[model samples]
Target: MRMGKGKTKLMAAGMSLTVFAGLLAGCSGSNKEESSSSPKTSAASPSASGSSAASEQPSKIDTSKKVDLQFYMLGDAPKDLPLIQEEINKMALEDLNATVTFNFTTWTDWSQKYKLLLSSGQPIDLIFTADWTDYQSYAKKGAFLPLDELLPQAAPKLYEFVPKDMWDAVKIDQKIYTVPATWKEYVTEGIAYREDLRKKYNLPKPESIETLEQYLDGIRKNEPDLLPLADNQGYHTESIRQLTTKTVNSSNKVPYGLNIMYDAPRDVTSYWGSPQHLADLKMYKRWADKGYWPKNVLNIKDSGHDVFASGKAAALLGSENPNRFNDSVIKIKSLHPDWELGYFPYPNAKGFAQPVHPIHNGFAIPRSSKNPERALAFYEKLVTDKRYNWLTQYGIEGKNFEVEDGKYYKMIGDAQSNGFPREGMQGWAWRNPEFMLFEKSFDAVLQMFSDFDKIAKPDIFQGFPEDWTPYQAEKAAVEQVEKQYLYPLNVGLIDDVEGGLKLFMEKAKQAGLDKIQEEYKKQWIKYLDDSGIQ
Candidate 1:
């Protein structure tokens, strides 16, 4: 979920990991490349063929020696992870003569631990990698092993399974360092509001900022117990950006304090000084004075989604990723069925959206891996084999979930409450849409995905490799300034919008905003010229 920086961190903290261990039992399996459009049976065996043309190639690599591999992922380990891990280990040991030890860098201090794990040369065989996690920078630093030759030999089926474009997108310095996920998602921001309350109060549909204000006003007037808009330090600015500019960030590498207009991709400037931002700040100040959210919202560490789910808030604003939105809706519906929910994609206000980048989620083998071959081997099974995928992604099938006609998925019994919610194990790293099961009751969410698929455009800066090595000090200083000045203005904590904007811009300049912007423009223009985009 690209819930901006703050919500991403909070959600990361709330996410639970479940260990899934299962070995591909047999050595005989189809070498044919699975059709990307259709779901197929499990390729439950590892074979030495990278493509259909190479099907007759015999296995030459050895797996005679037993080894135990350590796999690191983010988030807290779920209570049932060990159970799933045990099952996965049994299968892994039987097939590859290896077992996996699932390790998690819990969200509280994951960034520090993640950096230390790579820098200290820990023998981590497999770890989750993503665009959001500085995958390109780490790859450039040689923290990961190049997988060009290894994939064809160790994980032949997976090599054939992933498309050529995805492989190309994850390449750093012309070498593949990560196996990007085979799922296409639209992670644009949106609002999820209480439909029942809207009907009760007879509020207008929240299709734009103006309509949304009316909705918030109705809720504030009718519901004293519920905050009209659930917000946190991370989401207020994101919400304003979504409702106002409706522009995607120019580069994830640069601080989000800079803004890039959708029509003018090359022009990057501080959003705090923008006319739209000033108007948004004024509107937010009005909302704040009206008590749309709590006065102490910036200090409220509770997730906005959690606040909405707990019935303390009338609306939740966040990324519209299908899994994230659907999961939240499912949880809230289960808790309070009477509170009908309605979703409005922020892109709807602008009539366009962007699909998530291919490298948004992926897996990489650390340079210090002692069993890179086995790690890829296990990962291959996890992605291509339905048995392994179902076990790892959705837990123990009938016990944790149920499947209808092998397409739709539904949780059973106390699966969610017991801390084994479907797809909670950072499964995005290996998510293959071909084998993914849709939630049974998520018709609205599925429709939203379909709608986005029609309107989503290719992100112009997709796969733009951003190297911040040259401006490390400036980057740190700018970020520190954002935390101090930008965040307060974001939540409308400042009474004078003009004064706050001026002060924030002044502080940002002092912190080297101009220097960083100069470099950002240079790199962005170079990327455009290199890509032959006018």
Candidate 2:
């Protein structure tokens, strides 16, 4: 089974910020209108109970009237979701006089449903959001409400809990729209291969592209029943891109073809037309010929993780998101306890690693929210209150999981058999590192993150908001062209690399690629100028 849909393509980095203007502004704003509309107080304002590190502080904002909130999150709801939701609601009702309905947009149709939920003007109080989910574009389009006026008064603890730089990172034109997750993570791409197979073949550790190729070749020749590289559309291109780029450039999806040279962060170029891309295309063609992956990989609906765990694949290409990777490891161990798995981060090949963008995982209030203040209060509890955080993130302690010495998280039973595992509820939006737990088995994963932190560089392009509104037509046309030509080309399904490149470039130009690039450059230049970055 697939993990959460939040395991997105490896993302960009964060920028440095000096001040917490959003909090200051929210605190200084007039609250007379807000106070007048406050719900009438209940007869009894219950104090929060439990061993929560975040004690309930007396609030100036009234919570007199009861309210119901509709919150949306990605991925399928676990079988024990109702149980978790009931517990969460019980806490909310006692503390904030609110009840939240947890609505999950199952992975298969989450993208379509996420957009529809925002566009349909539903009374949604909070929804999970992130950079990969078009957060900048949606914020600019007025789909999310600016939280500067509500955070200080409604969610004071969260206001202070999230670092200043994070709030600054989520700002759209000087206004914050999302509450970014406080967790630090690296979303770098890597290969998860069968260590047993590698050892059986006596292959070297895959630290470089050449070594990785050798490993794949070994699998192709030795393991006749297993696919050399199991890859699905979601991660195949990204994995290959990481392998090809090395440390040369950092790319983002917002402006499609734009990229920043690592050595020259201010330099932007159309990556699709670059010589490097052509060389990468040739490499993919060679790999395809060697049967590294199935020719119909682009059409395969199964996730690479699924194929690998089913024991039909030798290697899985994916990101290094710890939670997802750990889950995959646990699942595979349950099925094939004797099969050893190994990981090789692609960035290590070039000694380059970048931490995930600050807004990589966050929550935003839709413009159609009926009770924004109450929603923030609930969210504050979810993020800052240890009881709420542990309950939502880890599920019911005895049944779903248990912690060892309050630091190591351990699943109670076979994770695959359990209805809820650690972080199964998509609680990523409110993850607080202070209360986060790690499994002892995750020592290698933690070591990977530690190693990455030593070489991490700041991504200059991430959080540089680009407004594509002016080039909507060009953006739409370019996306259509990419789907038709670039997708197949990236997967090496196109037979003639040179001819495919020529045709793809011709189609892209015809689709107004130049116009999109021009707008991107203009915005980038402006951002550099504003940030005082040369």
Which lDDT values do the candidates have, in the order given? 0.70, 0.72
| lDDT, residue 301, model 1 | 62
lDDT of 1 by residue, 1-534 (tens): 223553343223212110000001112122111212222232222323222222333223578999999999987676679889999889888878999988988765477689899999879999998776888878887899999999999988788766666677678899999998765556676788889989998999887778888999899889887788887774656665766564654123234466765555566677757787788778778888888887787788666766776667888766434556677777776677766888877777766766566567889999999988888988887887666776788888777777766556777754347456777686887765545665655555555656765655456554667777777788878878887887777777899889998998898889888888788778877875665444
Error of 1 at 409 (Å): 1.1
The runs of at least 3 residues in candidate 2 whose Cα sits more than 4 Å from the true structure, single-residue gaps closed, are: 1-55, 59-64, 246-255, 309-311
List the RMSD of every prediction in angstroms. 8.2, 9.3
Report the lDDT tens digits of candidate 2 across residue range 1-534. 012221111121223421322332243221111212211110111225532233345444678999999999988788888999899889899999999998998766467788899899979999998776778889989999999988888887788767677787778988999998755556666778889889999997766678888998998888877898887663565665666564333332324766655545456777786887788788878888898888788787666666776677887766434546666788778678898888877667656776666677889999999899998988888877778888898899898888665456788877568778778887888765556665666666656766776676655556667688988888878888987898788778888888998898999999889888888888877876675555
What C-alpha lDDT, on a 0 to 100 scale, does residue 332 get in candidate 1? 73
TM-score list, all predictions = 0.84, 0.85
Candidate 2 backbone collisions, by pair = 39-65, 40-64, 40-65, 41-64
lDDT of 1: 0.70
